[model samples]
Structures are given as C-alpha cells and as structure tokens.
Target chain A: MSDDIRKKVFEIIAEQAVLEVSEIAPEHSPQDLGLDSLALVESIFAIEEAFGIEVPFNANAPQQGDFDISSIAAIAAAVERLVAEQRGA
Target chain B: MRRVVITGAGTINPLGHSVSETLAAMRAGRSAIGPLEIRDAGRLSVRIGAQVRDYVAEEHFSRQQLGLYDRFTQFALLAAAEALAQSGLPFPDGRTERAGVVLGTAGGGVGTWDESYRAVYEEGRNRVHPFVVPRLMNNAAAGHVSMRWNLKGPSFSVATACASSNHAMGLAAQMIRAGQAEVMLAGGSEAMLCFGGIKAWEGLRVMSRQACRPFSADRDGMVQGEGAAVFVFEEYEHARTRGAEILAEVAGFAMTSDAADIVMPSREGAARALAGALADAGLAPEQIGYINAHGTGTAANDRTECAAVADVFGAHAGRLMISSTKSMHGHLIGGTGAVELLACIMALREGVIAPTVGYRAPDPECPLDVVPNTAREARVEAVLSNAFAFGGFNAVLALRRA
Candidate 1:
C-alpha cells in the first residue's frame, strides 16, 4: 500500500514537472525537478485529488506545513501518513 | 490642463456606514474583520471576513427597486446619493452635459449570480429570475449612477480585478483634467460575499483564516471585505465657482500593466506607476509624506510593495510614513482602492494617519516606517494611494493637501 502511494505521487509529480516518471528520483528537490510555483501548486492539487485528502499549506515556512517537501521521498512519506490517517478516520 | 479635486466622499464599508463614522473607527484603531456571517459557512475553509453588519436592504430601498438592483448596485446608489448631497451637485439650476460617472466593480451583481446559480444547479430548478442579466452585468452600477445623477457626458465602469476603483478614479480625474468633463462622480462598490464569489477566490489559495497583518513578518494572507465608496471628482475651477468644499487636490495619477504573470506582481511595473505619478505631478520623492500601501498581507505583496517603494523613493523611503488600512478593513478587492482613498484624505485633510492594526513583528524586507497599531497625528503635505491587482495592473494616485 505504501509503495502504491509513493508510485502515484511520483507519477503526479512527473506529470506536473513535465518529466518522465523515471527522471524523478526520490532524493531530488522540487527545484531540481524544474517545478516552479505554479507547477508545485498543481502537483499538490493533483495529489490532493488523487488521495481525496486536504493538504495544509503554510506561508513563509514550508517545513511547518503538514506535508513536508524537503525531498520527493519526504513528500511521499507525508502523503502516506496522511492517507493512513484518513483511512483510520 | 485643469486641476482635478475631490469635493465629496461617501462610503458604506466594514468600518462604518458613513465617512465620518469610518474615519472615527480608523482613529480609534478599530478592525472590523470577524467571523463571516453568511450561508454555507460550514463548507468553507475560510470564513472570516470584514462584512457590513446590521444592514437591512429593505430599510434603504423599496421592494421594486431591490428587484432590479443587485446588492452591489444598491450599495453604489446609496454611496452616490450621500456623495452628491455632500457635493451639493446637480444644483438647483440643472444637470450639466459635462457631468458623468465612472464606477468600478469586479463583480457587479455577484450575489444575484450566486443565488440564481444555486437555484438552477443545486436546487434542480430550470427557470431563474428574468432580471438576472441586467443585475449581473458589470456596468449595471455605473449605468444606474449616471442615470440617477442625470450625467450626460462620458460614463462607464472599469474592471481590472483588484485595481478597478483606482483605474476608474484615475480615468475620471484624467477626463476632468483634459477638459472633457467638468464633474465626474467616481469610486467603486463590491458585494461579492456570496458563496460562489468566496469559493472562486478560495481556489487562488491566497486567503487567510486568521487576521490580515500586512507588512508583518508572520503575516499569512489577505482577508476579504465588502462594501462601497464613491467620490465626486470635479474640476478645481468648477468646484471653486460652485462654492464646494474641496477635500483634497487630485494632483497626479498613473497606471501601468506588468504584462507578466497572471497572479504574481512585478516590482518594476509597480515602481513605474509610483514614479510616473510623481513625475506627472512634478513633485519630487521628498514631497510625498504618507503612502497608503497596497499591502494585501500576502508574503509576496508586502515584500514587493516595499521593494517598489524603495526603488522609487530611494533615501526618502525611510522618511515617509506608510501603512495598510487593509489590516482593519480587510481586502475589498475591487472596492478597496476607493475606500482607501479616504485614508489619504484623512491624512492630508485631518493630519491623522490610520494605523496598521494587526502588525506584530517587523519584516526586514519591509524596513520602512509602518505606522503600527495606533493612529498618529502627523501633518502630511502630500500622499499616494496604491492599488496593485492580481492581473498585474498597477494604479497609483497622488493627492495634495486641500
């Protein structure tokens, strides 16, 4: 189930970043993947739509947000946790 | 070229129902933003707004007029009436062919659209109101104002998203200055607190559930507000001949488009408008004593506005006092600039500068003196009011003390 969520996240990010799924590595930063503000927002929206969940975005402090984007892996990990919490709820 | 001056002003906003009341609220450091009292509040992620509370439409308008008039139009007519009464215009003699109106409204009858859409889509109804088209048209308020005042010259509405009112007022002043009109009633009104309107803005993700603290480091985002403000911008000689009390001299105005991003603001574009207005007025940067900043509380806007001010004003930037009344009134979007002009008049005419009430922490990016949390008695010789819209429209107006 965790791998499925990670794969979905990577696919969504690849589509938003205008890159192939294979080009997206777990360690790459969003900037390294060439994602601008609009692209990043679109990726978040796609993830929310796919998981049927809401993501909390903060101003001036991305680390404090519910979804961490230090790297692609961090985002996947956060999404996995949020999806798990949603299922439990 | 003739000089343009403001002779009359009226408003019905979150701060107050009249200019005196609104100025009084600003003097006491009052913020009217609170929990938004509207339908479907439970479904909305953000519910706090600066709404005009305790207003009953029936008390102000007849039932027949309400049928044709949207909430935005109603607010405009009320404000226009007050302003005309103050200006003593359309005098006992008669209306002039050189008189007209130019009002701004982003969503003219947004409330009517929201209600009709709900009736047809959500409630599964087919037929809607027959007057929906006229009510929802963007120029409805402007048309009604012109007809009511018997203004026969150039009259129209401007819709540049957030900078609508500033553009309208600037154009009106330009018309008067060019000798095309002698008297033009200008300003803006907005009543977009309906569910559809809020929901549409929510998609932009630039709203804050908390307070709007512009120029503050920890500020999150902008809070929405609603209402209208109208002013009579007349030729200086015309106003003087008619024995009208001049509120402030509309010294100079300039507008520019970024032509860049759809949502993001450009610093160079904003700086151009500021500098252009000063050059138009032939006033040096040192002459501007106060500025009502387009401080929308968003991180990008505050930083960019400060940078623009710094770019245009140079060393004088540090000396000038700047504040965002949005902290108290919320972001009215289209109607914001017109309502904010009142702050400029108050600062120039009354020597009272309204404070940015929600400011807590200082932002290094915005190092200018932001009159924070309390009103100050400072005699300002000249002032500038700024409005930078989402679509990269920048409008700046310079006003001198009357």
Candidate 2:
C-alpha cells in the first residue's frame, strides 16, 4: 500500500465526514468515524473519482463485497489494489 | 360524509397498458424489468428499468401535441382517457362541474428537463422550445387531464416523492368524503426512465443493476420503473345512481410524517400511519387481509416496513398476505403507489393476490409472509396500500371489497 493512496483516501473521507484530516485515524471504521450512509457513499464516490477506478461496493451488501471497508486503512488498501489493476489492464 | 368508490381504473405501466392487461400480468406473476432503451444507457452503471414498452407517441398524439406533451404527461393523458371512458362520465356536462383531477409525480417531465439541459449545456443552444415550461411543469399532467376532460371543480398535482400517488388518491377520497367533489380522477404517473432521471438516482447509489427483489435476502436495491395509473373515484351514491360498476370502496386513508432522517425510515411513523388507516376504516387489525407494501427492495425499506407491519398488526401480521408488486414492475417512484393500488383492488375484487416476483431467498429480518415469487388466490374483504416516500412521508390507503 502507498502512503499517497492512504493519504488521499483519508482526505476524501475527512471532507465528506466534515472532519480535519488529522482527526481521522486509519483504524477507524466508517461508523466509528461517524459517517452516515450519505457521507459513506459520497466518500466512496470521491475516492473512486480521485483514483480513477471503480470501487465495487454496494451499501446494502457492504460486508459481502471484496472491498474491505471494515476500516479506513482497509479501504485505502483496496483502492491501491484497484488502481494497480486498472492501470495494468 | 359521502362514501367514495372506484368506478373505473386505467393504467399504462410496465406490466400493461390497460387494467385487464395489468391484472392478467399480475396474475401470471410476470416481470417487466429489462435493459434500458433510453439515450446514454451505456453511460449508466444501473442499466435496467421497468419501461413502458412499444410506446409510440406519434401513434397516440399529433405533432402539435408531442411538442407540448412530455412523456409523463402523455402516460397520464392516456391512462386518464381510458379511465374516463370506463367511467362513462360525459365531461363538460352538468356533472362536469363537480368533477376534478388530482394526480402525482416525483419528477414531472424529467425527460424534458434532461433534454433541455443537454440542449443548453451540451449542445450550447441559445434558447429552448417555447413550450418547455408547460411541457415540464409538475402540474402539467393534472392540468391537461382537467382541461381535456373539462373537470372544473378542483385539479392539482402532489409531489411527495414516492408517496405522491397515495397522498393524491387519499386527498381525492377526502375531497369526495367531505362533499367537496362528487367525482375525481385520482392516480399518479412518472416517466423518469431517461438519461437524466437514472443519472440522478445513480448518484444516490440506491438503484440495482440487475433486478428489484423485495424481501429477498440477496436483494441489493430497487430498480426504477416508468408509467401511470389513473382511477375514477366517485361518490358512492353518485356512482350508484348512474349504475356504475364499483371496483372497491376507498374506505380509509391516513398520512404521517417521520420528522426523522430524510433518507432513513422511522418505524414508529410508519406504524402510526398503518394503525391510523385501520382505525379510520373502522376495521380491526384482523379484518385487513392484504397489504401492498411500500417495499422498494432496498434493505432499509424492506426491513423497516416489515418491522412496522409487525408492530402494527401484532400476531395478525403473520396471517396477513402482504406483497410488493414493485418486484415485478420495479419501483415507479411517485406513480408506484397508484399501480400498487391496483393490486389491492385485485385482492378485494377478484380474490387474487399479486406476487412479489424475483424472490430468491428470504431474509430473517423480514419474517412476514411476503407472498414470494408466485401469485395466490385469496378472498379478502379489504386490503391496504402503503407508500412511504424518501422524505419520511407516509401514506396508506385502505379499500373494501365491492
């Protein structure tokens, strides 16, 4: 995982959650970070748009999907993998 | 207070273009959801919608009419014509003064708005069509239905998102009950299957790409549908004097607001509306045999609605036959409740319960009998229709067998 990717994802999530970047921690879950459904969805969209890769996630089946949204660090790692795969393809 | 009864019903929906056609499709448990045929379908992640197929505007309207009628208005007009014909009401006559039109739509002329925006932003057009305002107005459908039939009493449109139709019909029934009007053409219509409509919903990320499977454990989200359903809601005595065919009685109606989160549903608010409707109809929980659920196939809605039904009906909720016709026709958004009302009518009049098609697995959270995947024959004296909108607006209508 790249720090650049993690930092960018944190920035997007922080913006949607209306919190400072420094206030967020990689171990914090979306719920723990206090992201509502709308905010969570916006964070995903912003992350996708920033990374130029589709994040395969459904709000209803968030737990079933391959994208690990269990924590902020997990989401960033998934985004790193998606970016690498999309660029390689 | 006057009694309200449905003397006629008409619909041009994904299931069919007529009442008989719709009932037959519902009986057969057919699904109309399919691939999108609109412009920029490839651009959308969610490409499926329950669209009114084989629709040709030129066959139904003239060139001048097409210029003024958006897709939503066209569906409303067609359904209204069929309903009025079935009702056998000669408009612009002596009785016309006591008749009115009240219809509903979530996004009025969404396609027109999309086209106009594209013309200005994408194509760089300096100006749009002169009739664009009239074509896309929210009241365009109701206004046209009123003018076309010369309904002079009261005519307007309601836009409470998904609950628009139920609210419109409920208000129409209230008007007749209060002696404000003897007859009303009440229902709803929506044509938001275009590029703009789906694109906007796509942003919300609440749409499913494949199907709308309400109550199914694997259900992802709702699929959008398009069409209109209109009915002739006439005073009982007025209908009887004319020897009109009575479909069902609009026995009770109740509405409530959650005042909670705009998107998330409140179980207490939904339960209050359900209990209120049953109480208004002077019927106990056990008297109600069927409920056309506001099951949008979303996890949040199905779970909350089931919880509400369970809370309202108690042990009787398990005995009640509740189904979501949206599984077959998809969520029509504003016009959905009107189309779902037809299912309630079928339950009361024909002893047929429409199935919630596309059910694969059951979710434990939704423990009630969902009448999954297959239509059933059941005799019921009364049934209820539920519509809860995005803004936490809840409206439920109860109907009695005629």
Candidate 3:
C-alpha cells in the first residue's frame, strides 16, 4: 500500500517535471527529475495528500533544499521516517 | 486633483450582452446560471457557471486575428467596441496621445492555456504553439483594447485576482487625476470557463454544487463565471465639456492587502478599505446609500464582509440596501468588480437596487439587509462596490450619481 502511495506521488511529479519517473535513480535529487521550486512545492502537496502523511517540513520555509532532488524512493524513505517519528517507532 | 466620471459602459454577462437586456433579466429575477456547457465539466463537483451564450468569436474577429488573441481578449474587444460606440468618442482621434487603456483579468487566456497544456501533456508535444505567449499573456486584453481603439497613452493590465477590474478602474481614475491621461478605457474580461480552468478551481475545494446563494445560510461556495465588463472613464471636466452622457462619478477608491493568508479573508482589511474609500471620496458613511458586497457566496467571505460593513457603517449598515450582484451574474472573478460596478453606477443613477437573486435563508453571521432576492426601489446617492481577491488583494470603488 505504501509503495502504491510512492508510485502515485511519483506520477504527480512526472506530470509537472519534464523527466519520466523511471528515468530517476533512487539517489538522484528532484533537480535530476527536472523539478523547479514551483514544481517541488506542488509535488509536496500532491505527495502529502496522496500518501496521507505529514512530512516535517514547513511549506513556506527557505530550507527547501532539505528535500533536494527527491526521487520516489527517497520520498518513500522520507515518509517512512516521518511516520516512524510520529508513531514513536 | 481632477475628478473622474464614468461616461460609458458595456458588458456581455450571463444576463445578456446589452445593458437593457441585462437589466431586464435582473429585473425579471432570472438567474443566468445553469449546467456547465464549455466541455468536460462532468467530473467536477460544481458544474454550473454563468456563461455568456451565443457569442461567436469568428463573427467579431477574423480567423487570423482569433489565432492571435485569447477568448478574454476577444471579449474585451467586443465590449470595448460597444462602450466606445456608445460614448461617441470619435475613435479618440485628437486625444490619441492622451487616451489610454487598462484592463483587468484573473486568468488571462485560460482557454489557450488549457489547449496548450493538452498538446504538451496529453499529446506529448514538446513544442508549444507559437501564439501561446500572445494568447495566454495577461496583458493581451489591454493590448487588444489599445490597438483596437488606437490608444497611445499609458496602457497596462491590473491583476488583483478577483478584484482585478476594480483595481483597474481605480488606477484609471488615478491616471486622470494625475494628468497622465485625459480619457481611459478601464474594466475587466475573463474567459476561465474552460475544462482545465474549472478543474484547477476544483482543486481549491470551495465551489458550490448548487446555485450561488450570497448571504444565505445554505450558501456553500462560489460558482465559476465568465464575461467582460468595460467602462469609458473621462476626466469630470473633460466629460462635461464634451457633452458626454455622464453615468456616474468615480467618487472614491481604496485598496488594501490582508498580508496574511492567501485564502482566508480579514474583516479588518475590509473595514479599513471601507473607511479609506469614504475618506478618499470626501463622503460620510451616512451619505452612502447602497453597497455591492463582494459576496462571493463563500462562508468566510460573506461573514467577514458583513462584519466589516457593520464595523464601518454602524447603524447605517442596517439601514443601507446591500446586495451581491454575484448572486445573479455568478462570480466573474477578475471581471466581477467591473460588471458589479456598472450595476452600482446604474443603481445610484436609476434609484433601484438589484436583488441578491438566490437568497433564501440569511446566514446568522451575515445578518444584514442584503435586499433579499428582490430588487428594491430606493433613492440612492452614492454606492460602494467591494472586491476582494485571492492572495489578500482588496479593492473598493465608490460611485455616485451624476
């Protein structure tokens, strides 16, 4: 189920970005996916809503580079980290 | 400072294209809203919009010209032609240098954007249409208006979201006051009723499923609408000297930003604008007779706007006739203020307040005399039209009978 969520998030990112989702490697950043700042923000919203997970990042924060070049695998790891932190895992 | 007055007005709203036809429709208590017809509105929660019908673009512009302009620009040109013709302003021949154009828009070329988006995303086309830039540009309405009428003075576009047209009108008034232009064409046009435009708004999650019910307890949210409304504004003295039929004077104007949330409205911002516009117009709150509320049918906007009016006008708030023409015309977004301002001008001059068409039960939070679903005969000296837009842009225009 969580893998499906990651795939859906990637689909949205692919919608905005010029690159295909399959072309992105797990270690590659979102810039590698050709996502600009606007696309990144939109992807964040799409991911949050798609996964029903709250990532610990401010929407308006300048620290946007913290999620630099986020691939679907990296995004899945980040969500897992956030969910684990919330669950006290 | 020179005074600014409305010398001419034209519109192509859901009600109708001509002033008489629209006024007749309003008087008959007919709602221009129905099911969406622009294509692929089947999936959206809100399928109803106040759309202009029987408008053939090819009839107005040649095929080549149509390729160069967006639907919004086409609407602007058509409405501008009507206004200029009514004003009898001789193509602005001698006053070309001193004449100008300013238009307001929310989603400049939404139809063009939708088509291009399909070409790129669905069709997998890497290259966009060459006319994409010109068709989707926000300034295209102003550019077309300038070109059509040979206006050579200061020309630009004002975009304050839904409040765009009011801001445009207010800025044009300032231009005349500043001696930058002797005559100005100002208003707004919108053509965002496309499939993608409606889908984009659906993401906001604030559209109503039923009809727009301004100030009503059952009000859910705003219905999307499209049209154009333009007004010819001349310096008060210039209009009088030219023997122009004065519609109304642009008495006062004020603009304020909430500087807060993008979607949430602020009562303080609205209240300050009301007081500021009154002060700018050199009129007392008591003297103002009618108010055309922004009244987008959103729960937050209606409540906040009601509180603002009550705060600013005190006892006068209860006594004054207030209505949301959006109830009938639907929310035209960028063009809403201009169309509503025309309604305000006519209300002040004709001494009749348009009804809030879909009003049924009044919201307890918005407990004011919203004139309630029926046009009322009353003596109106001055009228106020309030327009609040997305991202906290708020503009108000005060108009008085000539």
The lDDT per prediction is: 0.91, 0.92, 0.84
RMSD (Cα, Å) for all candidates, in order, is 1.3, 1.2, 9.0
Q: Which whole-number lDDT from 0 to 100 does residue B35 have in model 3?
A: 89
Writing each residue's lDDT as its tens digit, candidate 2 over B316-388 gives 9999999999988888998999999999999998899999999999899999899998899999988899999
DockQ of each: 0.45, 0.67, 0.04
Q: Higher TM-score: candidate 1 or 3?
A: 1
Question: Rank by TM-score, descending?
Answer: 2, 1, 3
Worst 10 residues of 1 chain B by lDDT: B88-97
Per-candidate chain B TM: 0.99, 0.99, 0.98
Q: Is the docking of candidate 3 incorrect, acceptable, medium or high quality?
A: incorrect
Please give the ranking of all candidate structures by DockQ, highest first, separated by commas.
Answer: 2, 1, 3
Q: Which candidate is the best by DockQ?
A: 2
Say which candidate scores most in lDDT: 2
lDDT digits (tens) for residues B1-402 of candidate 1: 799999999999999989999999999999999998999987888899999988999999888888889988988888888888999886323756888899988888899999999999999999998999998898999888887778888999999988999999999999999989999989999999878889887666678888999999888889999899999999999899989999999999999999999878999999999999998888899999999999999988999999999999999999999999999998888899999999999999999999998999999999999999999999999999999998899999999988
Residue A68, candidate 3: C-alpha displacement in angstroms:
36
* Candidates sorted on lDDT, descending: 2, 1, 3
First chain of model 1: TM-score?
0.91
Q: In model 3, state the lDDT of residue B21.
A: 75
**For residues B1-402, what per-residue lDDT tens digits would candidate 3 score against the true structure?**
899998888888888887777777766668898988866677665688999988887887898998898989988887888888888798847778899999999889999999998889988999987899998999999998898889999999988899999999999999999999999999999999988899887656467767889899878778888889899999999988989999899999999999987877899998988888999999999999999999988878999999999999999898998889888888999989988877797687777788898888967899899988888888899989999888888899998889
